[model samples]
Target: MARTGEFLMALDEGMLAYFREMADEMVARFGIPRAEAVARINRAYAGQEFEPYPDLMCHELPEYWAYGLYFKPNAGRLPDDDPDTDLSAWEVRPAPPAGSPAWTLEA
Candidate 1:
């Protein structure tokens, strides 16, 4: 993996736990297996750019990430099937300022 990839993969316990919770929620809500739920989450996030760890954890909710923030629902799924879900309204929160505490990690 590249250095950027390595850095992204180096999530702290809190971030790991957050993703675990997201997968678990996906399973419970969507009635999908754990592996599939995780795959979906990965697919949703693939090629997307954002901060990890404290930065993301601080500003984003797991449900937003798990459900509609990045995931485009063309696969016939629960939340996707729901006619009332306004996916168009979902948006990623603004990123923190460059020199803020959210970017204070040491190299």
Candidate 2:
């Protein structure tokens, strides 16, 4: 895969997990049919060259509503020697470490 093909998620795994959970909730509420919903999403992605952020819209369902985020990757990733080698074009905020110090008493 090309360098730009690499996906550096803006939301860390933790945040993404939460987002996915919420999205799932939305889907449950929308009650979108499996086949229809998948088709709808696929339609939106047709011919998408680059990652395009699509505004999530909901389809009213019997019991609930279903929503989805649409993103399409660019037609081609950046070249190997591109200036964005380090993804400098994108602003990256480091996630805080996921551990804490513990104190223990020793004799």
Candidate 3:
């Protein structure tokens, strides 16, 4: 297997070549200049992660999508398979010692 750098380089080269070929084809077919052709190639690339976030307010998404990322399923849901679906499974047995709960906030 190629090292991480080599793999990344290969991917970069492939994508760049694809853009270059598309730009060249568009220029030849449409009589577009190099700058405009490159701009077209770049504009085609603008999407998903590449596009600037327009309006990404957290509350804009569905309730589940908004909350699911910031918080876990049930606060007391334990991963252990002790055959119990109870909050007792997550009972905080010990109190904080010298230093304490730095910060706590929900919503």
Candidate 4:
């Protein structure tokens, strides 16, 4: 298996951008360090044989990947699974830490 850096460098442009955004989202929303976020994302995809990840993915918001929803075996959230579904508008926002606001309005 390729190292994480090697695997990341081998990604096509679209997948590279997608994973970059996904890792950034993980850092922002989960309060993780950027290196850790990237490592986590790398861990998920580094050894995988999936080709053209961007073309295969449903183009769900990066937040979905940050929340680990994309790692679920039966996420059932693909475009073909439900063309009418809009994951961005779904009510599944990540819960804030204890005593924090329930949600923040993203401008």
Candidate 5:
């Protein structure tokens, strides 16, 4: 594992826990099987190189919505955006499934 100086540690147990939680949320919200969700999550972080600050891992699900997992120091504060409206929350949420009419809305 390359050192980032900020925290010279690889994906440790805590990071794995966060990943697992995110995966489980994906399964519940997206109704995808556990194995597939886990794979998607893995792919999101597979080739990602470490950064001095937190790393944001993102994966596009079957639907139009995307999943983002933020890996950072717990002691440090995350952004203060409103959680309800913010899609970048720590946990993934369910969006309209694929083929839903919501996708056709004009931006």
Candidate 6:
């Protein structure tokens, strides 16, 4: 894992694409403006605790559940979870405190 600034700057292309795809899907499905969708995605990343496992990423939308993203060890690929699903139906949960174990997972 690199420094936060460096990690973001050097983000894997696939990872960045995944983020963008998710954000775009949010915009199309939820009717949010592009800027707001992008901001929400950025906020999700910014709100995460990366110190424990920098490669593991977690993002939470308040009262809207959370999700994890990471390359499976040695597989070099992301999981096939459906990011296109309508997440609005999910129960809302408060965002976990920074550094909380709930937001940390082994990469």
CA lDDT scores, all candidates in order: 0.49, 0.29, 0.32, 0.52, 0.42, 0.40
Name the runs in model 6 displaced over 4 angstroms: 1-10, 47-107
lDDT tens digits, residue span 1-107, model 3: 11122111122343444434554654554354544444433332333221122223222322222122222455643233223534343432221122322111110
lDDT per residue (tens digit) for residues 1-107 in model 2: 11121122233344333333443543454353333333332233323332222223212221122222211223433213233454334332221122311101110
The residue-level lDDT of candidate 4 at 87 comes to 43
Quote each prediction's TM-score. Answer: 0.48, 0.25, 0.33, 0.52, 0.40, 0.39
Q: Residue by residue across 4-86, what tens digits does model 6's lDDT show?
A: 22122224554455455665665555565555454444445654433332244425332121132211122332223377754
Cα lDDT of model 4 by residue, 8-107, tens digit: 4356666767767877776665476565566555555555554565556636777766766323323554322244655454433323343322112221
Worst 10 residues of 3 by lDDT: 1-10
Model 6 TM-score?
0.39
* Weakest lDDT window of 10 consecutive positions for candidate 6: 63-72
The residue ranges of model 1 lying beyond 4 angstroms of the native Cα positions read 1-8, 46-52, 69-107
**Top model number, TM-score:** 4
Which predicted model would earn the best lDDT? Answer: 4
Kindly list the per-residue Cα lDDT of model 5 for residues 1-107, writing each as its tens digit: 44221222345444444455665765665466665555554444454554332334323222222134322223454323233545344443343345533222221
Of the pair 4 and 5, which is ahead by TM-score? 4
Clashes of each: 0, 14, 0, 0, 0, 2
- RMSD of candidate 5 to the truth, in angstroms, is 13.3
